[model samples]
Target: MKTFGGPVLFLDRSDINTDEIIPAKYLTEITKEDLKPYILEDLKLSGFDPKDDKTKNARVILSRANFGCGSSREHAPWVFEVNGITAVIAESFARIFRQNMFNCGMAAIELPKADLDLIFSHSGQSDAAISINIEAQTLTMSGGGNQKTFPFELSPFDKALILAGGWVDYADQKY
Candidate 1:
């Protein structure tokens, strides 16, 4: 996608592993549709339930460092998309999970720590809209007459896959 923008949810924690994304019990399921109800189930323990009205409708998830650090299960990103998340912005991510996100068609954008902290700080305000421009490699945070743009990076291959709509779509066009 050229621009990732929408109502965002702040997953303020760090090192949120795969087991936490989909829970260990739901691992056997192969279809993203089948895994929707269970997305972010374990977040309930931490008092963040994705099924809740506002959270469930969130199109973006913004998190701190080491997000998706545990397992290499593709189901983690699968469940995210099934639950309506189109993109994820984080300061850092686990390698495998980052790859899985692209494979599953989710935009995983990385930003520097200072920028991430500012974004996190702004999450407290309701009705804010965040926009990320892929080509410019910048994030624009806007709300209530306040706006700021922060620079970010994306690899050429990763950027291409996301713009082409995930790995499968990218391969389909090339092959």
Candidate 2:
């Protein structure tokens, strides 16, 4: 299974779309690796630079609701996978986007608004990071001398997809 969690990149906005995750112009690239370096290149958030070290090093993304909005494309998740981002934690996700994440063996974790508020409080701190334990079904956020844990659930099929390392691998084993 893909490892999840590490330094968190907090995107303090909602409705972040696929085009922002990866500009559509690069879609014709030959490989997922070719799509790297362009992830989030078009995202226009105050104080967020796509080229920043924070972007390059983040292994998990924390964002507000409606992440992965806009077009339904597998390339968005491919970009994140190439970037070594194993998970995205948000208030909610676009349905297709959430499925696509699991299809790629990545976590699309949803937390209630109150829980998100608590987690967002720890964001932007230099030491902010998260630890995800899928088997335990819990997310632990720590930074600024504070820590919090929250529980989340996944459907049996979704859990199986993640554990088996995505749909293709799951099929390879099951069928």
Candidate 3:
């Protein structure tokens, strides 16, 4: 897949678990897209509207450590995918959550501690823009006259799943 760029939705907070991604109450929804409305239900209580254009239009998610620590709910990444998040760049992600992202055809890039710190420092800025180069395995963060490119790690096998449009698509081709 070619690289894509978009405004960054920087969630400065950390330790965001699966429940925060999609509340358990909405997990029973027939489809993952149905859970999009509650992508960050907990944020609403903090005066953040999940339906706001900023959130809805964000294609890149920048968060701190332990991004998805709680449940292994696949719906978490599904919520992100349906909401237009093709890439998630964080300092760290729970093991299962990272896999879930790949299963959903979303890039879950784990940035080095130093690189993550740089990104976080620019959070909340009006011009925070980040581009993800799927093929090149690079993340370009630019805004406010600043730009930097950082390399992320992703196994070739897992990358294949994402480029092929998730596991099902890959399996279809091989089988």
Candidate 1 worst ten-residue window by lDDT: 44-53
Candidate 2: list runs displaced more than 4 Å: none
lDDT of 1 by residue, 1-175 (tens): 5347777888888888898888878877766799988878777445466668657777788888998998988888888787777788998999999998877656888888888888878776777667777778787887667899988788998888877878898888889
Write candidate 2's Cα lDDT for 37-101 as tens digits: 89899999997898998888999999999999988889999999999898999999999999999
Clashing pairs in 3: none
lDDT, residue 144, candidate 1: 65
lDDT of 2: 0.90
Q: After superposition, how far is residue 137 of candidate 3 from its true place, in Å?
A: 1.0
Q: In order, what lDDT does every prediction score?
A: 0.81, 0.90, 0.82
Return the top candidate by lDDT: 2
User: Residue-wise lDDT of candidate 3 within 1-175, one digit each (tens)?
Assistant: 5245698887866788888878888878998778878887775334256778778788888888898889988888888877878788888899999888887677888888789889878875778889988888898999889999998898998799788878788888889
* lDDT, model 1, position 74: 88
TM-score between model 1 and native: 0.89
What's the C-alpha lDDT at position 138 in model 3?
90
